[model samples]
Target: MIVKPCIAVSAAVGLTSSALVGALHASGPGGLPRGARGTATRGGQGMEATGSGFDLGDWFKQAFTPQTAAAVKKKAGTSTAKKAKAPSGRGCTDAVLVLGGTGKTGQKVVEALLKQKRDVVVASRSKESAAELYDASTPGLFVQSGVDVRDEATLKNKALFDGVTQVVSALGPRFGEEGSSSEAVDFQGVQSAIEAAEAFLEQGDGSSAAPGDQERVLVAPGDSGSDERGPGGAWQPLDDVIMGGRSSSAWQKGVGGGVLERQSGKTFGRWAGTLVTEGGGFCGTVIKDMPFDATGYDGIRIRVRGDGSRYKFRLKPDTKLDNTAERQYQAPFDTVKGEWIEVDLPFESFVAVKRNYVDFNAPRVNEGPAGGKMLSLGLVLSRFGFNEYPNPKYTAGAFQLDLMEISLYKKPRPNFVLVSSASAERYHRLTEEERKNDIPIVALNPGGILNWKYKAETSLRKSSLRHCVVRATGLIAEGKEGDESVRLQMGQGDTLSGRVSREEVGSTVAAALSSSYSAGKTFELRRDEAEDATGKTPDFTSLFRGLVLDEDRSLASAGGASLPLPPFAIVQDPPPPVTEERKQEILNDPRVKARTAASKKPE
Candidate 1:
């Protein structure tokens, strides 16, 4: 009658007194679990102990209690209920995009989104891999192959952003991966995404569109307002400056400023302005605030679509016209109505002048010390004859000049540009002395992106997309990091290195889609120390919460600069004479036949 429950249980289990004592030692007193050290009540007497916060009685109950299916389900229901308490419509959506979906980071990002029950569109260069990665039977997951962001035609394709709400680019270069370099995937790829986002927002799916539904995601560059004029320097309209003429009838407007207007078909900037040069007065607009340093550029270029009129493309060394130190240079070019033509205004072709009339014989104004730095550029309706006096050329009436792009070029500037994540300064492995010496930074090297990181950042900043730039540390493929114990760590100063699972990076990108707070932010991520042994999906929302949201370039604080890249080299070669005997000799080689046979072997 006085037998304790523990003694009775031990007897049932066929345990001796010594064995019971040993089992009790392992489970602690009264069969309570380890780390259950605290105040306990036994036989109406209080007992004190010190250890974990967990109560001993609660631990014992959990350990001894046998759970039924109903009870297990009830616990799961409790967790589900807790999850339901989160903000409504804050979870994953039908359309999420992973741009470099086949890449290490991109592939992980795709999986993370799918696990959250969100539909994902995986975009990569290879169609087969993209299609093969995920099964079509799984609802909401899709694949897009043969997509190259560096190519505008592919980006402008309507199928690219179909029903897509968010885009996460894990697109980047790995060592030895050919064709997809940092420039192609990181910088240029990002820029393309930005452009696509702008287009998507502008042209919502031909139905009732909400502002939130219209929004998409991607990242690009930033502007310093120093050195590079940024994207703003790409086109400076006539409205930015003052327009003056002898005739009051002359007026100008910055109309149709299209960066990339695919809507309604036409897609080019049209600088439509009226030039009525009555009373023999010259009409023109001065772009005095041209802050760009045109150093290394051979000349300025303008794309014009205008009425057949002789116009003077002018440049000034100084900003002020009142100062005697200022010198003006003008080049006259004839335009064809309705036809777009590029007019190149080289410094060598410019005629220098002290007034509106130029002295063509005066040694071309010496181009000055700032030969390439043309501070002020202008478009003018100049007089027909510049012999001894200025005489009016065209009739005084309505005139228009359609301007597409204005740029400074040595060779023609590329229509598109690609950049690398290694462009970030901290990523540069080079020392200050090496950077100063202007060495070439190879993309395959550890810190290859320093030369182009800034460029990529700048491109993103100039883009139309609302973006979240997450610069991650060294990426580790899934199995490479052992088990999936990914604890996201965010910081600055480029201090964190080691390896982070690509899947973790993907999960973070997927989480970013749900938060508008992530927009206009740049942060760094790395994997923390191991947390558990078992493989489990990380808490993406919690990881995203750790993002710094700071725009500061972490690398700048580290005091690193990009190494100078070598100029483009042209290697010309004469064509080899085609000979049938040489071709046959190569084709009939035994080694070639063996290699061909080996390749043909079934996989």
Candidate 2:
């Protein structure tokens, strides 16, 4: 009797009666093992199924028949042939939350991570007037409950922390919203969110907060808090990167200090200009004053990359969360070019007496050794010893340097985020290979990307960021949708719609524009970039010019009241077709009346 090894046996014949699957030792075409795992297989006439298109289970079982098992086992080690385990637990780091997670920048960061298979949690920093940044695209990402972020317990979600990483912030002010004090998340509830993150990390619930490697992984380092966000306000860290390593011997000349230069590699200028303000006080850094607390965390460390140029770090006059006064400190560092270095500032540096830090228009509230103060790290480019000074050789100008990273590490390379693989896959299928890789096809959508080549597959499939831009210009040159190829460029907009496929390009000119525009109605949801390239900003002139072209055919069909000629020319009303009474009677039958009527009405 011929025996079949790969297929599962019927209930009547259990495993006892069934044979085990076997594997071949040799490599097959495409470098796959000859069989599924180097397991034993039952190979005979019953299991001689053809190769290609077999189900995964069948492929595994059939390829591992006893006839080839010994060869496979000997050729490859038992461990190398083992099937890898699947990833489990939460999708992202433990409680990977974003304060402004739904905001334009926040969404980008979140999506970038999510596309990398990270689970994300999101929340609006406030309760009212929030933009539509938050929406349904979110699946594995979680949204926090309620608007108040101060209450740690409220933001604590086990599902988030079950497999979470960090708390991030990408929220920013909407246009014209910056005037309101609420525009700055930095001053208000952001601190509350930070406190919540601290609580979450400490209770043994956030073990996934840190990442081990710089590239293969990114750490959570806890949540982020923000403020001073605006159109020109810039991303908070960017501002810090440019201004953190400032130094000077004196105040500006206008304010009675020596000259300062705005170039790179140049240090202090001539003469000992009092580090103090002309009024003998502190006035340089953007500082805050109020009852302060660091909880139990250590001192702040500023991370930046600089050429082997000297830089001075400073502190603020009033530590109050509301105080704007800052004083310079005497710490210096000769930084190497293009490498990250950490500068640690102990709290004790600024606590000294004689309180010479404050020098500004604002007078001292109370005298005796100005008690209220805190260190605010900031840079000073122009000052007494900065540029044109007696110390002529001192160099530091518009520093040609880029800042890549920054953080307040507690100790030497503090493991702010620890990484452990709750689950891992040995082979991560690249994007391009995803489709051709033949994953579950039914699981994907019609227009879904078949290729998963990071940027490789991108070039293969139709869309190109550069081409998307170039084609947009091309389509614009065409003036109207009908005049252009409409080849999936300028995706559906607020105007009408497109089929999202060739067949859907509105069978007619007017239909294509009117239909496709309506399809991509949510284009406005995007902020940093336009929903559709044209909508980058609303311009009726371009829209009119682009849509209403020299060829007014499309507009006319949509009842535009403009068009020199119809899409289809008039037939000149051909002489009334010859009709006889008997012939017309048969065509007029009610059963198929509509077609007969249309046929009789005109050519």
Candidate 3:
């Protein structure tokens, strides 16, 4: 007589009742009779043993090893596998230059960058001040004083750009100052930095992989006799005719129909047409099946010369929705009439819409695997703005938009990151109660700081380099020392009002440098008092993920309308009102006093 071997296995091995039954029938000694097979239970579907001499558990233990057990765990969808690692910084050697490095926020930025193990060059008007502020023995720290951004010659110093791949402009204007006015420091100073950065890109540092080299050029002038289609794919017109409109448009490649001409030994494309308001008013050109993975990019940068009219750059994601062709993500940009201008459109600014109406619940354009993938792109001259609003800059007539090149850029990595104030846009809308309760300088709008900061931001938006503008709310100046348990709260449309610590602001800026989520986007940031009690550290990734991209607020149609505020735990107890003595204390703060004193003298 043959004796059947007993088998035993742990339930944790993830073997199902069906699998055990199959194994028993296929591998059991002489196969168990049908009547002797175990019964399957509900829920977990575990098997019940019969009186048969064979033990399936013992057999499973003998058949499975640790590796096989792990495999089974994974196959059963219950494995505790580690998540994929996050993307790291550009490189270890890529130096970052920090303007105003000795200032309060700037100092915080410097500390955070050092913590990230990045090489930092501190640019200040006074080198001695920076040297005194930062430790001399600190690793990856360099101080370069006498580098005023107002003077174009000063920013052109080759030493500043040596190994420098990114720039963080923490510079702010001195209120009530003469030479150190907003135009000088806030606007033109940023302009000077952008020009210097562009010049640096043009003059390579002999490194094969330069900062701008990785740009994904979608549409560009090709060699003579080359195909009319660009690297972006075929160009076709999708005019208002589809909706029974009278508007007419076409995509002209090279010198076709006398619409475009060859320049600098290369040909260009033109989207020229007549936009009529009869029935509908819109003209556009699109390229379909253009597979572009804009995962680590800020947004699309276009070099175009147009008729001074506002035009919309639209995109459609690679999705299976039935109305994919009708739905799009668009951002409007104002064009220069006669001269060529490079418009940097960040991915965050693109608004989701269906048939020209804003869709608040629609999925973000860059919201899928690999950041996000695109199926098509188009340029539209439309009379309708978001949510059926009128395009304030729209004009109905013969129009021509000349396109030279289109490409994608990474933000804060190869771009300038500017730290401005949220009050720049909301100063005019502040409530009397808010003004009284807010910080002194913010309420006073000292030296027209609001206007100047807005001007500076506008200049950076129109510049050629990719950029991110972080508009921070009133900062909690006091108690920043040793208070490392703060959480961050961010919002769009400048509707948020609260106090954030300088440490949190600096941490946010440093976090933005390595995160693609912060590129080509603008938002208001503050500290979350409600979260302070949770004892959890701030999650910069989650904070940035909740932000919405900006639309061109310069448009008259895009007035003080704020987007829905991001979710924040309500603060049960608001901080006490600032007393008269407290206000004086804030004004007497070292940074504040220095700026106030400097305003009395000419730079």
Q: Write down the RMSD of all candidates, one decimal each.
A: 26.5, 27.3, 24.9
- lDDT of candidates 1 onward, in order: 0.42, 0.25, 0.57
Query: Which candidate should be chosen as best, given lDDT against the real structure?
Result: 3
Lowest summed lDDT window (length 10), candidate 2: 8-17
Point to the candidate with the largest TM-score: 3
* Stronger candidate by lDDT (1 vs 3): 3
The local lDDT score (0 to 100) that residue 253 gets in candidate 3 is: 43
Candidate 3: segments with Cα more than 4 A from true spot: 1-93, 174-178, 201-414, 428-442, 531-534, 551-603
lDDT of 3 by residue, 348-417 (tens): 6789887667888765678633246777788999888877788888789899888877777653442568
User: Global CA lDDT of candidate 2, please?
Assistant: 0.25
- Worst 10-residue lDDT window, candidate 3: 5-14
Error of 2 at 128 (Å): 58
Reference-based lDDT, residue 594, model 3? 38
Task: Write the candidate numbers in order of decreasing lDDT.
Answer: 3, 1, 2
Predicted candidate 2 versus true structure: per-residue lDDT over 446-495, tens digit per residue: 11111111121112112211011000000010011222223233311221
